[model samples]
Target: MMFRKKFVLFFGFVLFVTVAGAQDRYFTKTGKINFTSKAPMEDIEGKNKTVTAVLDTKSGALQFSVQMKSFEFEKALMQQHFNENYVESDKYPDAVFKGVIANNAAVNYAKEGTYTVNVKGKLTLHNVTKDVDVPGTIKVNGGKIEASSAFNVLLSDFRISIPSAVKEKVSNSIRITVETKLDPLKG
Candidate 1:
């Protein structure tokens, strides 16, 4: 009985370690987003701050979330209108993305290389969710991981209504870029 109990405890400890090492989560303090729209009069470019992402490497899954309230435009009036009317950031403060990496190939995180990843996930903005396919590059080097992606999203798909007054200022399609750093799982 004593031997059996010892063996069970040892096995349980090993199992815990194995499972704990499988999933890791990370976040970056500086993440950015860019937007562009063309009108008959002028072309506009805007940027946003405050993006966060969580990654589960063992499961090959990732989730990225951004606060819509953090989006900034050059013009104060434009920014205020964006938050209040267009994006409704006060109501839907966040845009979340949850998806899995489609590639079956295992990534050896210890090596230095770039891997192409097919990301399929749901992107939610303005309380609307749409399926998006974003192709990105993941680089693992010297215990550090870097990920980058650029994708286009249609504003109308997210039910973001544009007022006639500022229709020309905002574009129908928004281009998004993500840059993040990955850290190892902590104890």
Candidate 2:
């Protein structure tokens, strides 16, 4: 009886601490991410609207999760080739980015203003991880926050090679954009 009671009390304490720590966190499940490849002969575009993201204000930790197959392309054939040949959705089904706000202390989350910030983190896709330093903005308004960033990356960096058939037509650099509005967690 004593062991069981102690275990239950310990579990309760851990749960309380976790919930307390999460009060300063903000999260959204419907974040948006878009990628564009503007090439000489062809332009490819894809958008994913079901990205899940979490940001802990206290620790400056931010993370994003996205399913590889969730990205939608305008052409069905392109989408099929993207999953089967490019990203291989069956083997590597998710892409994640875990980073921290470099200027966490400068931004006042309680104030209604927009703050420019730098985020440093690791982006993992297609079983490859790369370090990225991106410029972004954090907007605090009406007790809510909106975050956005746009950056260019080389497809080859993640071992994603453009197929020979379209190699000459596609650009090596691809532009990526992220946008998300987050609400504070209430516990």
Q: What would the TM-scores of all predictions be?
A: 0.83, 0.88
- Worst 10-residue lDDT window for candidate 2 reads 162-171
Tens-digit lDDT track of model 1 for 15-109 = 89776774355456566766766666566666766677767776678887888777778888877877888788778898888998777255655
Can you tell me which runs of candidate 2 are displaced by over 4 Å? 1-20
Q: Which stretches of candidate 1 lie over 4 Å from their true place?
A: 1-23, 104-106
Among these predictions, the greatest lDDT belongs to 2
Candidate 2 TM-score over all chains jointly: 0.88
Q: Pick the candidate with the highest TM-score.
A: 2
Count residue pairs with overlapping backbones in model 1: 0
The models' CA-based lDDT, in order, is 0.76, 0.91
Model 1's alpha-carbon lDDT is 0.76
